[model samples]
Target chain A: MDRFRVAAVVTLRRSIADVQGTTVEQALHALGFRAIENVRIGKYVEMEIRAASAEEAHRHAEQACQRLLANPVIEDYQILAVTPAVAKEVP
Target chain B: MKFGIVVFPGSNCDWDVYWAVRAGLGEEAEFLWHKEESIPGDIDCVVLPGGFSYGDYLRSGAIARFAPIMGAVARFARAGGLVLGICNGFQILCEAGLLPGAFLRNRQLRFVCRSVFVRVERSDTPFTNLLQPGAVLRLPVAHGEGNYYAEPSVLRELERRGQILFRYCDAAGQLTEDANPNGSVANIAGVLSPEGNVLGMMPHPERACETLLGGTDGLTVFESLQRHCTMAVATSAVL
Candidate 1:
């Protein structure tokens, strides 16, 4: 299987109010650092998968999101391929 | 019987849950979205189906826990209504504080999807009234942040109250890491409230409702609820 890179980018839904983010925002204001606004916490994850082809890797990665990673309700995800690491010489 | 399936924006299992309920208990089911202020009138039970709600952004079900509809579900749960949360739904219940503990990311920090063995821990809860304790059932679990965590006191309390309903197990029904797919604190797979009215599990029962698709072990969850609720109503009528 060819090696592929996958990342599951998870985000807080825009519709739901984020109390955690709000508290952080409040804490920021209290500290008097007002430049940063609307801090949204999200998960930017990267992983490597061994697949026979890029399409195969993408299919499994999509299934991963559908079954587990990304919540269909409020999260969106995009799968991509990063340049593969060079194969080391076999001993 | 009328069933309520809550639909959140990122809830991927909403449709699958609807079909499972209909297939198990017949039609007369309605979907209540996360933004709604109330559950539809006289709904028999509520289901919080799985998926990455709000994209599992901050944490799985962390943001979805505060949805307007959850308030209604909270009220319904307090009134002793049957509620089951699968996967992300399970995470939501924990985040909402309707159930104890929380789900952290997998220790390995990877998404896991596979059929695993679940040993029914207690048959007393409304969610598991039909199964015998120690019964082993194979079910599908797909998740990234399914590691169950809680304060020591809460863990003891959960143990004391028989709130831990399902536990991950191996083919031999032995509790082992082989069964612990996500490194959950106690090999915990599901939990229930003191009243047994609310249940939350990372495994997807709806996905297991059909044998043709793969497995039907999940059907027992809904069947048990139906049986228990029907009996509860019958006994109440007699009184």
Candidate 2:
């Protein structure tokens, strides 16, 4: 089995109101940085999985996001990256 | 009419529900640990009480919904067994797909803990059968994430099916924004499954079951379960 590092990025759906993001945007505006627009905050989850290939690891990550990592009703999730991990030599 | 309270790792209100059922209401009740795979055969109603399960780490009730006992709870609920989820339990129900909608962080991002007024939007479900439609109830709500949200179509369907059980409102039963403790959509405080056997609410019914604690409006909720469970057993026996 290949060891793969996967990242699952989750964010609130566009239709859903991002109350926390709005507050953060207000704070940024008060700091005199007005260039930010639609400044939304989301979750970034990373983990290592045992799979045969990066494709399989991506599928596993997606399944985890669908089942538990992110709630689909109001949030969207995507497998951001998947890379095979290097094996370490035993001392 | 036996009641089972599902106790997760971080469940602090299991005893509250236990005392409310056995001592306050004089009913038979037991604790169902989260690790238990199946509920006892004679258990008539199951309650998922309030508190931070898994430290409310990822989200309220998200991880607890995967507890071993939940599979059995889902099976029981599908077979028409009564299930009630209060506060964090309510969040778990939604995450488990036993109920609709998701609870977001409170609008003000504050952990609100206090008593609030709610109006019974529907009295036909097992949770509110003893209440009258439009009746006002005073219950305590304590949580950091209680803003309920659902798709527009789902909200419309719930409205059409009379699944909305309770809503925050004024003492006069008016739905006003100022009276909404958590900015829930349409001021909704509680909802019932389409079959009406599963109910979830952010307010603490177990906390308000006795007059000495505060008000007894929540007593009707427990009393309603007793009435429904007893009648179901009697009806099955007669059949």
Candidate 3:
């Protein structure tokens, strides 16, 4: 079986307020970064899975997000990447 | 009446709920470990107390909702058993889908800990049957993510169905913006499930149930539950 590395991003839905993101945006403005606006914050989760194909790995990652990683009531999640894991090099 | 207080890995208020029910309110109460598969048959009510269950990981209560005992809790709730979730317990209830709506980080981005006045929106539910309509209660709410949120349509439904139990208010029972400690929608502090058997609130009623803790206004909540259970038993016997 091939090992795939998966990464996902979970963010609050647009309809809900992102207080942490708003706080960070305000701090950035205070730091003189005027161009930054609507800076939303979210969680980045990464993991490795053993699956036959990238499609299988993606499906597992999606299911994980749906069941555990992301709460659908207020947050949205996206599978960022599902790349095959490379073998480690011997020292 | 017997009460079961579920204890998750990070549950810190299990004993507080125990004391509120066992000592403060004079009821039989016990702790049910999160790993337990089922609740005892004699438990008349289940309480999810306030605390950082599972260390508030992955958005508060998100992880604790999957605890082994939660399956039984959900079944019990579905069977029309009474369930009261306080603070983090409220978050867990929402995450577990036992209740509608979700919590957002406090609008001020701070963990607010103090006594806040909440106006009783309705007194017919099991949680507040002893209280008067629009009664103002002083309860302590300590949490960082108590800002309750729901879709506008859901909020309308909650209002239409009289599911809203408490709303943050001023000492004089006014729904002023300043009285809202966490910017919850419509200043809501508590709500009831569609079946009216499950209740979730952001405030810590157990913490305020004793005079030494500063007020006894919260005692009425527990007392109301006892009264409701007693009345139900009497009615069932008559039937």
- Against the true structure, whose lDDT is highest? 3
Which sections of candidate 3 miss by over 4 Å? A87-91
TM-score of chain A of each: 0.67, 0.91, 0.92
How well docked is model 1, in DockQ terms? 0.02
lDDT of 2 by residue, B1-239 (tens): 78999999999999999999998789999999999999899898999999999899888999999999999999999998889999999999999999999999998889999999999987777787788999999999999999999899999999999899999998999999999988899999999999999999999989998889998888899998888877877998999
Q: Model 2: clashing residue pairs?
A: none
lDDT tens digits by residue: candidate 1, A1-91: 5787776676656653444566778899899989978876566768777787777777887887665566544456666554354555799
Q: What is the per-candidate TM-score for chain B?
A: 0.97, 0.98, 0.99
Find the 10 residues in a row with the least total lDDT in model 2 chain A. A80-89
| Cα-based lDDT at residue B40, candidate 1 | 74
lDDT of 2 at A91: 90
Q: What lDDT does candidate 2 reach at residue B16?
A: 95
User: Between the candidate structures 2 and 3, which one is better when assessed by lDDT?
Assistant: 3
At residue A90, what lDDT does model 2 achieve?
82
Model 1 regions more than 4 Å off: A1-91
RMSD of each: 16.1, 1.5, 1.6
Minimum summed lDDT over a 10-residue window in model 1 chain B is located at B101-110
Residue B193 lDDT (model 3): 98
Candidate 1 residue A58 C-alpha distance from true site, Å? 44
Better of 1 and 2 by DockQ: 2
List clash counts for every candidate, in order: 11, 0, 0
- Determine the TM-score of chain B of model 2: 0.98
